[model samples]
Target: MERKSQIPRKTHILVISQYFYPETFRINDMASEWVKRGYKVTVLTGIPNYPMGKFFEGYGYRSRRKERWNGMEIIRIPLIPRGNSSVGMVANYLSFAVSGFIWKAMTDIRADLVFTFEVSPMTQALIGCWYKKKYHVPHYLYVTDLWPENVESVTGIHSKAVIYPIQKMVDYVYKNCDRIFTCSQSFIEPISQRGISKARIEFWPQYAEDFYRPVKKEDSLEKPKDEVLNLVFAGSVGYAQGLGILVEAAKILKSENRRVCFHIIGDGRYLPKLQESIKANNLEDSFNLIPRKPAEEIPKYLAWADALLITLSKSDVFSITIPAKTQSCMACGKPILVSADGEVQEIIREADAGLCSDAEDVCGFVDNIKSFMELSTDRRNELASNALHYSETHFNKERLLGRLDEIFKIGA
Candidate 1:
């Protein structure tokens, strides 16, 4: 008798994101892993320009629009980058939404499911829901930030007319998606209140890529000598980071002769203003503003630092938003200096990873830095150890990747 043959399941995934590989987004790693799991993954993204306004070298309309990356297909669409001005930022978002709409309407490729790696400008997910409606496929949305709330918090836009339309767009997207995955548990309430059923939304914490783990300090990166403590802040230099408070704290530390040097690694629109502030305050000696480092190279910077600093503007929305760098800091086995509120503070306190201060509180930030400096080497190591342990237990890469299978299976 001949035995019946079994066929492997087809898991064709279409990922909609404005950012992808070569950009330091967790979605890039997630897509690569899905490909390794035998799923055929295709990313629909804009050109590589991110954090920096200009297109990345060798990438433009003249360059290849479609390419293979780590066993997945990458299809680039046309969109204006977030250039220096507020008007330019709005144009960037609109450009992507329009171009993405055209591309989705014209593309013939079908998927068993659609996934959106929603960072900000929730407009990116608009295309995913569009695909779902057109193809009748399950749409899974991983919301890293909440819209309207995020908009108002980040941009200080409070006009009812401006917010009402955006709020409607957000609701429409959430209502259409089959599942909503939030990076923080706190996100569940806002999304639910937007009329999305609680059953449809689930808490899925962000995980650091494997490359983010602790590494031996590289000699190339400068580390302060003698008794000075190196406190590093790595990521965007945007207004929302509330780095002005850091500048204020630097002024105080300088006056008091506190041996703490702030190593700021990243760049953004706010950089020019920050540089001006540094010049005005004569903080050239206290602050080192380094350009953004590649994701793989960041662990070395973390290793060289005595502690890592994460800050945000004082806003209700920011309180619930956990900076993605938080996990990376913990994964690097470094003590954290968090000057934010809500979930971020809770994470630091629970993991015993580091200390926290109120956002934009210059005096509190100064005090915390001094406190970290005063902690014994053994105590600091203990905090670092706890941080690593927390990352292992709560954010193990493989464990988190394993969870994705269920999400993919939802509509398969």
Candidate 2:
């Protein structure tokens, strides 16, 4: 008698995110990594309109709707472009959620599990919930932003009338999801307060991409040929970033005749206001506002700097956030200059990676910058070494991805 062997089935994962590849998010790398690990991955995302508030050159509502990238399938749905206005942004989010429902009705894609990479608006998780209901699969939510709080922070709307409904929506999503993963440990209590059990929520911090590594200064094309102490801040320049403090700090540094230059890279809604502040203060020479560059090119800019700058606005929601850039900066082996609060400041202190100041503290931030400028070359090197070592031990990409794999297997 011959015995027949049973073959294992491939786990198909459906990822629901409003942003995806070509949008400069870590989810792109995660999806690719999953594909490399032999999981069948399909991404359901909207047209690529993000920090720029417009669609990418080649992507649109009517074109490039379905594509393949890095061995995974990408299905883009039609949504309103995110123009530079509050109404436009709201419309953009609603359009995606509405379109997602329509797409699910017409499509027959089935998956073993549903995963959502939630950043803002948080409404995208509804799509994953719908899929879970239809396919009887577990839905995992990776929450990068806390809703109702995030909405209040981004917009100035504090009315309970509006926030109550948003809070209800958030509660529904959290309740429906099988498991929830948060980027910061502080988020656990908040999620639990929403009637979710602590056991259902886990803290799964983000890891840096492989490309984010130490680059020799001499090899970096972006390196400035000067003796000035270069401090580089790379990421979105939104109001939540609290970059306005840099302008005031630059004025103080310039008055003291310090050879320090603040280099801010990236673009957002608040860029024009920041530029105007620089021009108004006549500190343009001390502050360099470079245009946004690709994520792959960020290491080169980091290598050019003596320290990496990280900041967030003074808000309860932001205080708990460990910005994704924190991992990126630590991975690059650069000394960090933090003007944020809570989790990020704690991480910097724990790693001894660099200096920290409370959010929007111009004097404290300036003092930290000056102190770094006064440090000996050996001390600077020590900070850099500490950063890289901490990243390897705490946020190694391989280890985190392996944990993710285990999570999926358990859920499946």
Candidate 3:
């Protein structure tokens, strides 16, 4: 009975995220693990609507405001859905920030620490900052993307007057938060340049979800019996991804009669444009746009690929960011062909996972694809082996969780 006294007190963690379970964000797994470890985990999130804009089926006007998901108490607030336009996206962000503020103000749920899972819209962190101010609890911002820079890059907005308020919002969150956790090491320098102290920010990389692992391809996972070498690009086909480069590469490959096929999965604002480009190029047979599938099904698709492709637009902000899908592809134990610069390239180089070409470099992309195609089976397998090894060594879920646990326990 005396030994029971040695057990640490539970850390009550309140997670604030615009995205959560059933929508595919890392915070879901993190919060689930927190519950398993005997911590009190509560989530305050917006209604289920992301990427696709429309609310998920059975969860619209009459749904309950609060619910339970994976042993945590979830509080969902009403917010505008993110439609596929810059103006609509801004409205969505503002709606969440406003609704989240009202919910937190009225709710009595107390937390030892408030943690935010930041992506796309940086204004969501504003709620966490407000909670910190009101409750005097430690607010930890987990930044997957940086704002103002990301905002300007994604929207192509060059006017300082338009971006100044967003910059102030970013600066406000940065100054008020107790500590910042970032997914990329490269993010540190950029974040510090915004007048934040390096010591307050920690580099915590993204990990593949539990379901993203190597699985044997069975008869049920059969692909069409074509001699075409399959190269797959998975994830949102948005402007940020610069998938037009892949279309250009496909044209070059077809011109030279390279027996390669590019399969693109997932939807975004650019999917229509990508399809149109493929049609106009008369390369529909070479580039296939498969409809988006659920997260669980992605591993099978990865297993079906000869090589996985990842790319980012040629923007300074994106160069510092490593797409979370990079970790997912590596975890699936497949050879990766990267067409991006900076941190992701550095990772691929360090792991010898596959090959890299400059973003938007169509010829460089074509050359890399041809080079990959020419590799012997043994060489390709070796690269695949290296990718699996690197994922296990660096980006496993357990390692990242343990680090986050330590951070949460600080001054507890």
Candidate 4:
């Protein structure tokens, strides 16, 4: 952080995220990409707390901790960690916002613009707005989740009693930011209806540095099979992912005399229930559920599968946003199964990766699976190749984020 500001900075960028590396969220990639391009970047984030809702070992609340990763400076502070539920989650988010503001305000170097991620830090966007006013830090806000709408659909946490204030809070933050980011291709309509102009917003998708490159069939698989098709889902087992539908589709595939296996990997609050559902359905032989693996291990699984599944809930809120897994899956050069509709559907069609089913329609899910399974080897390989090409050109970490560095003037 002591690097000369006279390095002719286009602008100094301060990324305000409740999660970052050592924590592992999309913000880390975004902030780091700018640094790679010679930007002077600093990240203000909370203690490493996620999934477990507790501070990561060796790290605790109070006082600021700083470290350098790949030339970028990451500044982590103590904040109350919240679990993935209403009360605790809100408290966790509030604490980060409160703590980040107190600590960031006292720093010597000022930022030109502040960028805040949408999810978590439920109340932190308001604090970012306050910073914009106090230090004149023009801002960029990324709406990763649609908030009360998404929370209600996933957790049933809000009502008219609770939503109105949240809406106002959303409005306050959006109104103040110079430009807003809506990562999902589907998120534009809802907020645009609320007064955020289309011109002020831009699309930013999750990126993984093409680290998810296509895995060689022989090098990546554990139990290799030359003739059978394998399909996989590699993220959370949570309700928001609509994984129940994946299991249902697996049952259908089994009935059809198809040989494809469904591989689900990742741990979440919903894992136990998912296991129970599998047992109740007697699907032990057809589906395989595995624990989450290290980040470096993902491409191997993608290489092991013929196609990858990506889904969002039937929740009105989730339909508008494409999950990051969709991009990761495509990056691996695997064909895609995008079960959620709208912009997500458009993305798959555009990529020529694979087909989408009607949201929540198990019958359609089964049909799509069968069709993909029935494809000729040449056809399937062609689709997979198209998906990989699309991802590299459109979603790679370096190419997709140049606008971000330009906006912050950090790498300009």
Candidate 5:
């Protein structure tokens, strides 16, 4: 007699993130991927107000509170919209923690483990700590942004009064979580210094989505008519991106009569300032600021470019971060032009994927661009190939996800 195969029990995971689907965060994909892997995933997040600092259309305080997308359940709680102001952002962060506390107390949702995707406003991790304590389950935190440091970097708050409290909160969350994952290995030491053992922390780098590969430019997409080399910078145009230096570089390139153009795609809080700089410098002809496009459309834009650009502000915290865009640009099979420092520069150098410059180094950035402009077609293609190969070997999505699956299973 043939024996019937037993069905494995689905390990339910409660994911805590302030941002989710429709917000274009990697967490959306991770949650969906977990669902695909036969795990029950439920997201506890806030109303979608991100780079734009407002709620997405059709989503609000009372609208679509609970929903399902890509086989994962979503539970949106009440939180102030992150309006375009520092005070509003603080309120938005605090409100989520308060709302999540209330929801956790009232809701009977069951989960075997808690996973928190921490970008900024590390306060979001507090909910995961609470869930783990209440349910006696493991809590894993993926630290994309280092707290207190990120807060000081973004807010320019150097006072110990402000940072001390935030540091205390960071310590509390770090102490409570069972396993901590950092996006960059550089982050490990800082977290370890917080009294958490290095053995409990792992570096799990971000991976590009499957759709980020090289694609043929569609006929409908208009190609540049000029012979100028185009460098495309895609993703958030925020202050942390250190895009202002590009304006300075464009000025030098324009004065030198270089045949090059910068195409920046995406919108963020820093866009207005960047635009003002471009206009003030009269470099409009040298720069193109395109509106934000869907994630799926980025590859096409990248294909139209001669090289891709990625930058970050000059800060100890920023230096350690390998921006998610770095992986996406590499996966697009294009030569990258990096104007940042630390881990990202190392990645580009190790892969031979592109030129690198220290953060805020205007002359170095321009020199790199000029170097790219002088490269032969074959040389450029070689760099692009290296980038694609590096992405496949080191940042493959399936491989990272499988590793994550093992970690989750063991924790469960």
Candidate 6:
């Protein structure tokens, strides 16, 4: 008698992130990585509009378009473009909400799992709940931001009238998802208070193993050999990043070191202000502001620096936050100067991966810079070695995604 063998099923995983590559945001790297692991990845994302707030060039507000990149199916829907304005942000979120739902309805593929990325408002999670109800699929809600709390903190909008419903919406998101992920530790208590089981929540920390990697200098960052010292700050220059302090520190270090220069990369709202401060302080040559380079280009900028600097504002949203750049810099084999406090403090201190100062301690930061340059190659190499080893062991994207696979059975 011949026995029949059962064939394994291919996992068709649907990831709902409003911002994806080509569109340009956080999840693109995640999405691209998922595609490598053999999961049938379908992204339910909006039209290309992000940091620019206008539709990304070459992508219009089309009804639907399926793009195939490296065996992954990217389904893009029309979303209202948004920028740094209140009205624009609403239109952007609503556009994706309405269009994503419409596209989801039209598609026949019932996903094995849905992964949602959190952003400005909590409403995005509601859309995931809708798909779960509509298709009987489980979802993992990923929180990059804590919604109304962060929005209110950043925008200066505080009123119970506005806060209640938004808080309720956040609660709804926590209640509905099968699994929850947050970028900040501050969210743990607040989310647990909502009665969601702690076992269901996980933290991704701030990481990107792909874009951030250790590379030899000269061949990578294309930086001219420095005579005195060079410091680099990569990633978005938003208000939350508190980049101006780095500028101030550079200003103070100006007279001390002739060759000391701060290379600030990436762009954001605070960029112009940071630039103005540099000019106002007559730091045109000492403080250079460059555009945001592609993820691959980050290592170049990082390798160019003698040390990496990562910081965030003292906002409640930031206390729990670990800037993704920290992980990126660690992977780049450069010792870091971390400025945020709390969980971020513990990570760097425990790993001996980088140096840390108070969020606004310009002098302490300066002292670290002085110390970093004076350290022998052996000491610097030790920090670089620890950072690389730690990133490889804990922050491996494939390993993280593999964990997600077990939790959600993504590619099983």
Model 5, stretches more than 4 Å misplaced? 1-6, 218-222
Count of clashing residue pairs in every prediction: 0, 0, 0, 1, 0, 2
The order of the candidates by TM-score, greatest first, is: 2, 5, 1, 3, 6, 4
Better of 3 and 5 by TM-score: 5
Give the number of the best model, judged by lDDT: 2
List candidate 6 stretches off by more than 4 Å.
1-8, 23-26, 104-107, 255-258, 410-412
TM-score of each: 0.96, 0.97, 0.95, 0.90, 0.97, 0.91
Q: State, as a TM-score between 0 and 1, how close model 3 is to the true structure.
A: 0.95
lDDT of 6 by residue, 228-251 (tens): 577788877888888878777777
RMSD of 6: 2.7
For each of the candidates, the C-alpha root-mean-square deviation to the true structure, in angstroms, is 1.8, 1.5, 2.2, 3.6, 1.8, 2.7
Where does model 3 exceed 4 Å of error?
Answer: 1-9, 219-225
lDDT of 2 by residue, 326-402 (tens): 99999999999999999999999999999999999999999998898889999999999999999999998888889
Which run of 10 residues does model 1 get worst, by summed lDDT? 218-227
Instruction: Summarize candidate 5's per-residue lDDT along 194-264 as a digit string, tens digits.
Output: 99999899999999888889877562143763798888899998989999989999889989998788899
Candidate 1 per-residue lDDT over residues 257-310, each given as its tens digit: 887778899988788999999999988888888899888888877778898889
What would the per-residue lDDT of candidate 4 be over residues 1-412, giving only the tens digit for each residue? 6875564654567777787877656677667667767667878777877766777677775534787887777888667777656688778877777786787577776877788887744577776787788888688888888866776776676778778887887788878888888888677777777798888877777776546788887788455345667778887667678778877887787777777677887876678888998888888877778777765687886777878998776877777777777778888888888788667788889889998986788998888888887889898988999988888877867656766767665311
| Candidate 6 lowest-lDDT run of ten | 403-412
- Evaluate residue 190 in candidate 3 and report its C-alpha lDDT on the 0 to 100 scale: 79
Clashing pairs in 2: none
